[model samples]
Target: MQFTSGYGAEPGAWRLPGANLRSYTDMDQFVRYAQAAERGKIQLLFFADTPVLDVDLERQVPHFAIDPLLVMTSIARETERIGLVSTASTTFNEPYSLARQFKALDVISHGRAGWNAVTTSDPAAAANFGRAVPPRAEKYERAHEVLQIVQALWGSWEKDAWVLDVDGKRFADMDRIQPVDLQGRHVASRGPLPIPPSEQGQPVIFQAGGGGYGLELAGRYADGVYANPYTIEDGQAQRQALRDAAERAGRDPDEVKMFAGFMPAIAGSRRAALDRRRFLDESVDLRQRVRYLGAMIGLPLGYRQIDEPLTADQLADAVPSPHDPRSARALEVAREGWTLRDVLAHGVIDYHPVVAGTATDVADHMQQWFEAGACDGFSLAIDGYHDGVDAFVDQVVPLLQERGLFHLDYEGPTLRDHLHAREQYGLDPRVTETAAR
Candidate 1:
């Protein structure tokens, strides 16, 4: 199965109970983490970025402080096999510029670069770009256009376009270069990208979003998907839905790999792991939890007592912010006439399924999900900088390898090669073609 390290250096990442790691801002720690992941043969080191500050700056880590692509560039020289994926917003960036940057990264990394496509969701980012936030539909519409233009630009230079002929005094074949004269309702671009395609084609595209619009975009163009499925059943349904959408889009379903998020708190034994989980869970302050609940519901719940039962009227008064996708979950709970404590009890707010156990126990859960066709692999969410990742690499990876559920060594170079390696494992070919049936 494909393995990706979802670097958790952002604000709330450090707030988990029992977390004693240093700040993610420490470059030394970050580099060490990347090296450890590479040693474990993780396929991708994925970074989640925001164009503007969206969280409480005083309480949370500012994600925008460092540009992910630049950081990836630094890591590129330190490792050879692991893939580097960076997030870029179609809403805030022009297609041509984004294309050029990724092309450069792909070249520098020898075709191991990936771009995580995102239409900026934080309304505050609009101000940074000096514009009002567009409606959700409009943002996605623009994103679709942006993607087309970027792909066109990346294809502008044909293979073998570059010819260094000393006798002819020629640098490139003019006939082979073509302009991408594109004009759509939301975007327009006319150009041939200056950079040619890297050794492995354009940087692999990764996309993440919630709801239908997001899924449709991923189905149409993404090579890999960072999905949010909180249950095994939910994961199965989402994977099937993505494949169905791919069929309708006239794309090969197997080409689109689905990666569900996973965070494991492992120890020597299952009981010890449970104890660690309890410590971490209890470490989270009530105020912070209430604030998170407010963000999910799109309104503050600070005034209400933690144990107070929420009324429909109170919920109805608190309208969901158009930008936050998780607001739907809070609304669902409020509609059920549940108490504030119920929201905390269900743990419905987390993006991924958390598994707490021994290495074998964790491996068993992962095996069950994979065999059940829940996802192509997992994007591991780390709790600590060094300790968290090191534990899994040392303990969990060997178990997965022993079970023949994961790769023993580097299969091939390039992110595309790593993603396509799944075909060799005898996965059901029909998994991606389920929509046709």
Candidate 2:
């Protein structure tokens, strides 16, 4: 499972701010967290973004985090080897600015940066962006167009575009760097972006939309996928589907890595793990529980009971995860009576999987899934405060290293180099340059 640092607003943490990070009011604190994770040889540091604030998560949950990109900019200067990922929404932001920001990050980080492509789904985001309501099918189309434009911009400067011609008194060969005449359906542009292609070419693409169109688009282009994995069997099945889709889309399936969002709450003993699990289950407020349940089942906000029997239809309706309106997810949770506590307790099942146990046990589950080809890795979305990340890095991570399942130290300087160390960087050099119009 891929570990992600969100959900908590933790204070007094050394490595990462816990899920509830409301207490961490320091800007430099985020930098400290990223630096510490790098010391652990953690592979990737990721963040997610929303165009607008909705459901009053801060009022509901413990804390709300900062802008992922800005935080990563600080990380770019302070850390090395650890892959830095930023989440950006194509729905609200323009492609040009988004492309430029990610490119600049890639350059400053020495290619340790990646962009998680997303479509803004929150209703409040629509309001924030001058839309009365969210657009459904159109958003995916816009994302596709945005991806196309961004890639072209990244490729605008050819490998030899900036050869200095001192004798000729020229800075670059204009012929080598050409505009990309991209007439997008929703988003379009001309480019050879102001910045040349960085050492890593461009930041890697990470995707998480689970719908068919989103999966196909990601399959065609993304380097990694951030996904929700319930069971090992389910993850394997999803992996297979992604592989098949890649084949159909005429891309190499191996090019994309899977980082399932998982919540593994580790403890020294089975009893301790269980106790921690219980505390988490009972800790959440009850109304939030109803909202969470409705969200999960894709039902509208309404009445539900704790002991209410879940129906096949209700469960089926809720099973389809919503990408845009939190309302759809909220409705499902409430109508089905999936309380906040249950939502938190289920972890990866209804929630992302939360593994609560000793280091050995937690590593065992991670290994089982890895060897099974269910996922390449997991992004941990551990519970609040600092204990969750602390235990993971100190306990579970060490075991993974001992088993040779994870890296004891980073192999390369760049995120792309580290992720695909043995792979060729110029594998698609020709794909990098399209003549300017």
Global CA lDDT computed for model 2: 0.66
Query: Which candidate tops TM-score?
Result: 1
lDDT per residue for candidate 1 within 324-375, as digits (tens), equals 5556656676666655655554344555665666778778878989999999
lDDT of 2 by residue, 1-437 (tens): 12223434211122232333433344455665666677778777887666555444433531234567776787788887788887888887777788889988988888888888988777777787787544668888788778878877777777777877899899987887778778877878877687776667788888888878778767766778888766677798888788776666656778778887666667778667655665655534556655555565555534445445455575556554545323343444444454444433434233565566688988998898899998987877656434565667778888899998988888778888767722322223322222111
Alpha-carbon deviation at 62 in model 1, angstroms: 3.0
Clashes (candidate 1): 1
What TM-score does each of the candidates earn? 0.79, 0.78
Candidate 2 is scored at a TM of 0.78
Cand. 1 TM to true fold: 0.79
- Which 10-residue span in candidate 2 carries the lowest summed lDDT? 428-437
